[model samples]
Target chain A: MPSPSSTKPKVSALGSFIVIVWLMVLAVAAFLATVVPEIDTLLGRSHLDRTVISAAQAAIAITTVVLLILALSIMKEVYIGRKLR
Target chain B: MLQAITVVLYGAIVSAVSFFAVYFLVPVMIKRLVASGHVVQDYHKPDKPKVPRPAGPALMAGIAASEIILYILTLDSSVLAILFTTAIAFVVGLVDDRKVMPGWFKPGALLLAAIPIIVLGAHPDHLNLIFGRVFIPLLYIPLVFIVIPIAGNTINSIDVLNGVASGFLIIATIPLLVSIAIFGNQDTFLAALPLLFTTLAFYKYHKFPSRIFPGDSGTVLLGALFGALAVAGSSEIIGVIVLLPAVMNSFLFLASVKKIIEHRQVKARPVTLLGDFRLAASKDKSAPITLVRLILADGPLGEREIGIQIFKLAVFAAIMALASIGIQYYFLKDVIR
Candidate 1:
């Protein structure tokens, strides 16, 4: 029976957290591109190989998809054993 | 001149085909859904208004047909990829509409929908940035899997009110089309037109006091296509920026509820209807937060007013998206080869 007005702060906190998370991701992606050598530049060196970049990208991609899929599974069970509302 | 005119005329034919398909079929769909008892009650009203709920099939048919025509004209692999991903998204939604699946099912199933794009060789490995000056390669394929589901769900999450999904899409799509055409992807440009026009046709019936709901099928189909268009056009940044509001709605909902349960599944309602049918924010601590509830925080507002507020935010995001294009063209001007 909590009044609706008091519920604002908690929701606001979550909203701010998510928006910040997205912005942080954007910033990081932009930063990573700035710092890391372009793939072709790295590939031209006798010592450097495309496989290294491919492996890194694959690792990041797979980990993100895995984490997201896991999140979805957890959300489904949030109200576990409860009847459909 | 003649060839340009031919493409123009052909584009017109494609637009007409898409528009009329959704336009003519929606009324029949409303009748059929109502007759078949596939309806949902509008809880905000005292009358407990019931609305037909099968606009998805009509939308899917229109989009599929128009995209096929675009593919016929261009023989673009990207065009075909868009059609398949969208149809798959629609079917995934239909599964939910026919019978409730666990909250995870649709998102999980949508992952497979990205396969057609990859298998068709439509997605390329390279990220365009700083006006196409900065290229990050080897990121596209993995990102494709993430983009499809996120887009489908974001669109689904924003369909809380009547016409919001289709209307918001019209605004969100303007920049997508602009950026695609300017970026010189003729096939994706032509492919995207059908989506814009299709949503325009559906918005006619989906607007306030709606006769029918887009349901999960309509929303997810549109969402997936929007994402697919971005992927195909190689304009993921533009699409993401244009859809920021809907993405925020998804983020806000998930962060608040800490789960993926349906809106109807929430124990406490986010907004409460007053005697005048104006919706006010819910005070219950247990009620999950939503964009509507957050908007209602200042005071109670009618459903129409709330819908307008969401549109206003979407337009602002569209402008921001357009600005990114401006930045690209200005800073990346030399790369306009």
Candidate 2:
């Protein structure tokens, strides 16, 4: 068998794209981490019922989860779609 | 000034011990393992050389010895926590290396590794989320159990090509070391040196055209220790961020396969070996998606090139991790403390 080639491979656009997506995810996560607590404090100061504040926090948390799922879905679609093409 | 000198000396001793231990032990392991007929074929290579595996004992020995010395000097329970967690993960991985285990075995077994951290009270109640911190006193315990298995299995999954596991560990570790140094105590920073140096020494042999593979034991030990370090140092988010590529690889694999199954048992490989020995993404839709496969989406490449690409992704993740650290330092400095 011939010796395997040692040619340098070009970094794919997809690799760069994935890194960008990762950054986006981090940014979103950081934004939520910063904002959610403030939102909780603001609601607390408004003298809203404890149940209402808790419900809003839970909703925000659920939305964050949904967003993460959507991002993963996009990643999977892009990966499979690229291969198919 | 005298305190600074002592800290430097301690760090140097830990680094030297771990580095030299793996450096000296790997060759002996190769000879003994091969003599005992415990070798596996390098599937990605053209020659199909039989390489001895489970360099785990040597790796564990190096890490444990260094951490033991650190604990003796400082009497820190966190040091003991890292050492015990890594030792337990090493044993779990070694068992898998010697036996044909089901897919669930390693992940399930790794959860037990978290016991040392919890029992030793090594983890913090608050999570550092870069922009803010969250006090998750009750939730953090379960998170510890989940994080170890995820970290252990994530590294285990990415050990596909030669040097990838060790190489990835070397890259992914930089941010952890940096984060620990910035936000953690001197002891925690000293505790992380062995991880960097051990993997560095192991990579000399485990790199392209590997002389010996890390197998399950080595990978899981490194991964679990990494998780333990992050937890012990209170840099969990930084750990996850630095390991995003491996985490993404695991996510893709699980999503594509839609089940917890051994890669060995999977009938459809994500990448196919070509005539020239370069790897191409499998055209089969049934194949599980992987980072290697994603990298090969554009075209086939040699194993070493693929490894380099993976490292590049890791470096990108490391940069992002550093940026996250910057965010914490510049913006959340008052909030975090």
Question: How much lDDT does each candidate structure score?
Answer: 0.77, 0.87
Off by over 4 Å in 2: A1-8, A42-63, B335-337
Question: On residues B102-130, what C-alpha lDDT tens digit does candidate 1 reach at each position?
Answer: 88887889998899999997775565553
- Give lDDT tens digits, candidate 2, residues B1-337: 1278888999999999999999999999999999999999998877889999989999999999999999987888999999999999999999999999999999999999999999999898877877677666766898899899999999999999999999999998998998888777678889999999999999999999899999999999999999999998888888988898898889889888888888998999899998888998898889988889888877788888899899988888888888888876675567543
Docking class of 1: incorrect
Indicate the worst ten consecutive residues by lDDT in candidate 1 chain B.
Answer: B129-138
Candidate 1 displacement at residue B164 in angstroms: 0.8
Indicate the residue-level lDDT of A79 in model 2: 58
For candidate 1, list the clashing residue pairs, or say none: A3-B283, A4-B282, A4-B283
Candidate 2 is graded, for docking, as acceptable
Candidate 1 local accuracy as lDDT? Answer: 0.77
Give the lDDT of residue B179 in candidate 2.
Answer: 89
